[model samples]
Target: MKKEKVVLAYSGGLDTSVILTWLKETYGYDVIAVCVNVGQEDDFEEVKKKALATGAVDAYAVDVVEEFITEYIYPTLKAGAVYEDDYLLGTSFARPLIAKKLVEIAEKEGAVAIAHGATGKGNDQVRFEATIKALNPRLKIIAPWRIWSLKSREDCIDYAQKHNIPITVTKNKIYSRDQNIWHISHEGGNLENPWNEHDESIYMMSVAPQDAPDEPTYIEIEFEKGIPVKINGEKYDPVTMLTILNKIAGENGVGTIDIIENRLVGMKSRGIYETPGGTVLFKAHKALEKLTLDRDTLSFKKIVAEKYAQLVYDGLWYTPLREALSKFVDHTQECVTGKVKMKLYKGNCVAVASVSPYSLYNEEFVTFGEDDVYNQKDAEGFINLFALPLTIRAIMNEKKIKEEKEVI
Candidate 1:
């Protein structure tokens, strides 16, 4: 008789490591670990080694940094999708791609089930399971956190210690963090208490704003069809460009946001997110859109952006609505090609200038100085026609008031 195999989404973290051993010990299942790297600062070889060492029958380290950026990150960026007006949707969008990889590997391995370390309370559980269900509904979904006896990170630490597993997380430093090329998020521990201020030591990708250098950092970004193509007149691939931008922006303390956001799980959670490069990109991209996009299109796109953010945050990326919204966003980006100069200083990212060939801002039309593009006398008729409805309403109201007074 052969044991059923389970494909586990492994990060070589304390949770997944303990779960890998636990699944083998408790359930008698042959566990295969899969670590998908999306530009997080981790040694993939070491993660694989740790997974194998922790009793995984086989382990794989999949590098999808380029695909993550081009397919997932860029589409979200072009959509201008920012959750709750601040979150860059870094972890949100990445979860779907990760789950997709897990499903693919599970299919390849002839596995009966797929498992993930996402907790029952967080939004990630929904994200992972949604994508898995959407892609491959037949595979069993095992969420250890929802069923395991270990109640907290401290318990996970104990479990790992007892199993003699190699883990970096300890009781003293137990902040739950998720990192990728786009951003790093810090939650749990002190962050659970909304009144408690986040310590400066928790900063990972960026320096504290107060500790940033006195001088401002200026950079220019060029976009083609609303996708960033070059920086400072030099074109680079997606991964390298974002890596460069992260270095510069992080040094200047450009992106660090602490917010109490409404989780998709129907709870308010506090998190600290560091998205240095993403913040600068969002500001610059929005500036370019302002320069090139028409008034009505831009206004409607704002509404679309909010909905897009909701879909990503709620883990509906693989659904039909998200695809339709992306198509609409792509069409909007057709004219959103331009250059934007940004100023980064102590946590502030400001767009200093923007220019586009498709820009509708014509100096000849709106110049206060003498210009032939407009007739000075044209405003009177336009205003009169625009105000006619308001004037009619006011007249009706006055007539009603007069009638009431006569009745009195």
Candidate 2:
């Protein structure tokens, strides 16, 4: 009898590689490994080879970098959704896209189940399972960490050795990492201990702030309706633009954040994120919005931004709420076209100048000197009317005080 097919979200890493073999050996299933590449630094051919060697009947490597940026990253960027005001939601957003690919491949391959290597303790487990269930509810989801006896990374290492699985991770260097075009995240190992300061060596995409060059790097970014279009006057496609900016900003140590974030699993997990290009894009986009958006719209959108970040972080990317939020965010981006000049120095990405065609700032109205656009005498009446309620309250209080003295 043929075994039921399971499409495993394979990364050729320690956990997934071990899962590839363990799933087949334990469940007696024909494993089809699928690896979705979202601009991570990995050799896909090697990954496929490892999957096949680890007892997977077939393996696939899908490149979704362009789709990831244009579809997922751009919307979140437009919303300015930063998780807890620090995390850029890099790993959070990538999981949905990867899970989406898993569903597609599972359907195409006629697989009955989808498997993921995400541990039960982390947010990725929720992210993957939630996206999978949202997209294809019928498919049976198998999460190895939640079930299997392998409880720790050390156990995974022992299993890999016993199964002859090739893995790069060792006990000495055991920081669990996830990487993509937007950013790279480091967790596990010393990060689990909040008292342990992250070693500079763990940073992959960016230099340490202290190690950055003395001279600052200035760059001009141009956006078209909140989507980044050009860098320093040269237009680039999404992939190329991000790649260029990541290198430049990483060199300047532009984005490295260490935070203890609340996980969707109701636990506090500490992680270090490196988001060089994303940092630059977000700062530049915010600067453009400041110049173009009115005070009320900008203020209200901040509330929307917090909710949007929460949705993305919780892996509700496929829900109607996220779609609705995206529509709202897109509507707000109509005038978010402009050029922003940013200064990058030692992990700081500051927008120094911004200009937009729809800029609401008026030099004549805001100038301290005399201007024809406004009359100084008009302020007296405006202030009087604005302060009328306060003045009335004070007069009433005085009358009450005088009446109380007479009564006494």
Candidate 3:
């Protein structure tokens, strides 16, 4: 009897490893394990071997590093979309791309369904299923976490041990982590208790501010239309620049954030993020925009940025609103070409100077001592008109109070 084929979004983690075996034994499905690498460090060979040994009919590891950065990270960066002001949208952005590949593999291999190890409680489940539904509605989604009677990681481990499966999870160190080129997120474990201070050792991309060097590191970034093109006067591609910046910023103990955020799953989830490269990219880009963008555009874009961040965080990546917002953002970046000099010290990214060809800052007009433009006396008329409504309201309030006292 030929069993139905199911392609899984496999990561060689404890949950997925157990899932691979469970799908075969419990459901009688021919499992095809597809691991998509988006810059997270893993031994692909060992992952593949484990998948094969754990009852997967076929195992494959796909490298999507360059594409991950170029297509996903760069576009998000261009939009300046940071989720909840701290997250660089690492996990959220990677989820859709991985789901797309799973859909492709399912179509290519004639698989009847696709599965993911994301638990029913988490946001990844929503992100993955949403992408799958948008990209390929015909393909069925088998979310084992929702259906399986095995309640916890402990149950999964017990199943693995009973089935002679290799297991790595232990009770002592049980943090759920997601990593990519943009950032590494640490959750679970002691993070559930908001009072528990995060152990600094768990962080990978950045060092603790208390341990940062006494001396500061300074760097200059050159942007071509809001896309960082050079560091220290040397031009490099997007990925390469990010790689370089990550090394430099991480060494200096920068870009670590601890926050309690409202999850898309209607829960308050606490996390610590290490985003060395992303922090540098955002800081430099902001400094460049100060030089390039006009006051009104810059102010308006802040509102757009807040909405954009919320949309991305909520995993509305494929919606028309997000697409429309992106179009407006891309327009703002047209003249966002510039160079910004910044100083990094003890987790602080400080902008020292910035210059752009399209700079709206006119020093001659802004200087207080002497200027041909921006006459100081013109402000008297401007202030009068601006305050007229407020003055009228105050007078009316006084008249109303006097009338009330007379009636009393």
- For all predictions, the C-alpha RMSD in Å is 0.9, 1.0, 1.9
- Residue 335 lDDT in model 1? 89
TM-score of each: 0.99, 0.98, 0.95
lDDT of 1 by residue, 176-269 (tens): 9999999999998887899999998998899998888899999999999989999999999999999999999999998899999999999999
lDDT of 3: 0.86
The local distance difference test score of model 1 is 0.93
Error of 2 at 222 (Å): 0.1
* Candidate 3 lDDT by residue in tens digits, 1-408: 988999999988888988888888778999999999888878999999989988899988988877888777766777777777777788888888898889999999999999999998889999899889988999999999999999987788788789888877776777888988778999888888999988899979888877888999999989887778899999997678888998889877778889988889898889888889788888889888888888899899988888887777777778789889888988999999989998989899878999988989888888878777778999999999999999999999999999999999
Worst 10 residues of 3 by lDDT: 70-79
**What residue pairs are clashing in model 2?**
none
Model 2 misplaced stretches (Cα beyond 4 Å): none
- Give candidate 1 regions above 4 Å deviation: none
TM-score of candidate 2 relative to the true fold: 0.98
How much is 136 displaced in model 3, in angstroms? 0.3
